[model samples]
Target: MTITTHSVTLDGVEQRYHVAGNGPVCLAHSGGPGIAWDYLRMRPLEEHLTMVYVEPIGTGESGRLAADTDYTLDNYVRYLHVVVEDLAAGPVALLGHSHGGFVVQKYALAHPVDALVLYDTSARTGAEFFGDAVANIQRHGQKILAAFTSQHAEMTNDELTDVLRTIMPAYFADWRVEFEPLRAAMRIWSGPSRGQDVPFDVREQLSALDVPALVVVGEDDFICGPRWAQELHRALPSSRLRVIEHCGHIAHVERPDVFYPEVLKFLS
Candidate 1:
């Protein structure tokens, strides 16, 4: 019932995290590879599970890498491993959204975990995935398309935050209704484009993992849609897939009625 925030020094870098609720521990990693952790807060799930929301390095109060470009998935996984060790809570469940999913997937493969929750994410970043995202943006309109294309390596934190707000509508099924509140609450920091230069296909590697996993995606999510979720399910040996109907990339925010229950049940 109590919420506490803590920061630890690892490898001379600071990593911050928030803890709440009381039950089996669940370590959550938010997306963006740069977005602050607050957006991934699951108050409903907190009632059933202890949630450790991670403030990933390069965002919030967490320390940054020597170079922004150093923010690779492997590096993220390394830091995450330290965080898990610091928790010393034994095997813990890992929940990752979008880019965070990529982190957990890599981490879970190498380390032991109670379970894995992959939300609105993909196992690989391919041309087809980005192509679909572009098509979805085109359908939405020019402003969003422009914002999507405007992203560059040199974007400042404030500039990137502005662009995220501008383009966030495309991340939801019904942006008109959801945009305002999310816009007000959203916080984005500019981090390096992670693992873009390296190949990120984990499909073949997934079969070796015996851990149980739950792959949940927004039915209407353009970038990491049901297609990728299906791909993840097919590859992971002990994985289940759940597609939230009438939702987009941010299912937890848009449809908690469905998202929270499904996740809580899986975790239970």
Candidate 2:
């Protein structure tokens, strides 16, 4: 129930993170590559293990770099590596959601962890996954088309939320009823941002990851659906895949009843 926040500087960037509860360490990374870390603060997991939330650069109290700064995946991996080395004394459970899942995959490749929890993420960041997402939404008809039309480049926090709200249905199986509560807990942050045009393919590297991993996905996630999660599970030699039926993108938020227990069991 009690949570404390802290900061540690790495190469001029003041990295901000939080710690709560007790027991083994759970180093969690939020997605968006630009959003804050609050959304992934799973209260249920806090009761059983110590939770460490790492905010991405430029978001929350974390320091920002210049406009021309490199936000590539490699830069993020280095920053996170320093953060983990500075904080965790021994092997810790690494948890990541969405884009954060991508970072954790690479992190596990570079660092050893007791366990890895990947939520709603894929093995690659290219058209293979995204192209499928587009076609899936189109199958739902014109309303989904209208939602996609609202998307724009370089949007502010509020603008991005508005756009997300329009397409919110695509993220949940029961979006018509559960959208409001989901939106209430959801917080969006947009700091210094840029395009991610660099190539990111790590499927070939997954076979080398020997640590235990749990790949979880919502059966109905429109974007990174179960198919992507299954692909990631197949690639990781020691990974198990769990699909939450009737769930969407944010399974941890939408189906905590299953999410927290599954995670606790794996970490145990």
Candidate 3:
């Protein structure tokens, strides 16, 4: 299949997206307000759907905000609105991983979407989420925990990349076996936090949503683990939950066999 890259100007900033495969259009937003979009590419799903992998603003060739602190969920959703309108594909299905899931949740509530796939993400972010993340890293080892702790807004791209690589193993169920290539391929940008001084919670509003949603999470995801996925499933009125066995945060990469089939079936 051929993959085509395109860019669109949204509110004077450039946003890039890559499209491939066939069938219905599914817009995918990668995790990490900072991670490049390449890692989220689901080649298998592409066979059955036209995958539009969004290169979210503040990463890759996409434009950056004047101040890093301006990178909030609202802005991400706003830019995403423009991208969807540019596609002219009405009510496309949306798949969001981690941070992208937060964006998708917010967007779906306000706008009309064909469907939603919330992968390894939480509907809220607060002390519990932050505490769980720290606890998980500690279980791996203090060295990684220290690397995770060292992350600061002021770090340069190279510094942030180093920290991400150092803590990458924690993101998978078994990193030593088959995740080395993905680690090497990772391109992390040092963007600002979502700029939420208060907790980010949309659980209360999710019950009102009627859009079909599939909540998928790796059985062992550290940050947004099964707890969050179950919460999402419970909150969403029209939703189903799937937890892939022997997997972590990036199930699409770590367990494609299980991930793709479930996702395709949902989309179908």
Which residue segments of model 1 deviate by more than 4 Å?
194-197
Best by TM-score: 3
Give the TM-scores of the predictions, in the order they appear: 0.96, 0.91, 0.97
**For candidate 2, what is the TM-score?**
0.91
Cα shift from native, residue 231, model 1 (Å): 0.5
Clash number by candidate, in order:
0, 0, 0
Query: Any runs in candidate 3 off by more than 4 Å, and if so which?
Result: 194-197
Instruction: Give the true-structure RMSD of model 3.
Output: 1.2
lDDT of 3 by residue, 105-172 (tens): 99998899999999999989988888988887788898889988784576877788888889899999
Per residue, candidate 2 scores C-alpha lDDT tens digits across 1-268 of: 9888888887788888888988888999988767668878888888989999988876777887655246667667777887788775687899999888988888888888889999999998776676788877876668766656454446787776666566667777766564587666555554434644465679999999989999999998888898889989999999999999989888886788988899999998
Cα lDDT tens digits, model 1, 193-225, are: 532447578999999989989999999998899
Candidate with maximal lDDT: 3
Q: Which stretches of candidate 2 lie over 4 Å from their true place?
A: 139-152, 176-179, 191-193
Q: Would you list the rank order by lDDT, best first?
A: 3, 1, 2
Judging by lDDT, tell me the better candidate of 1 and 3: 3
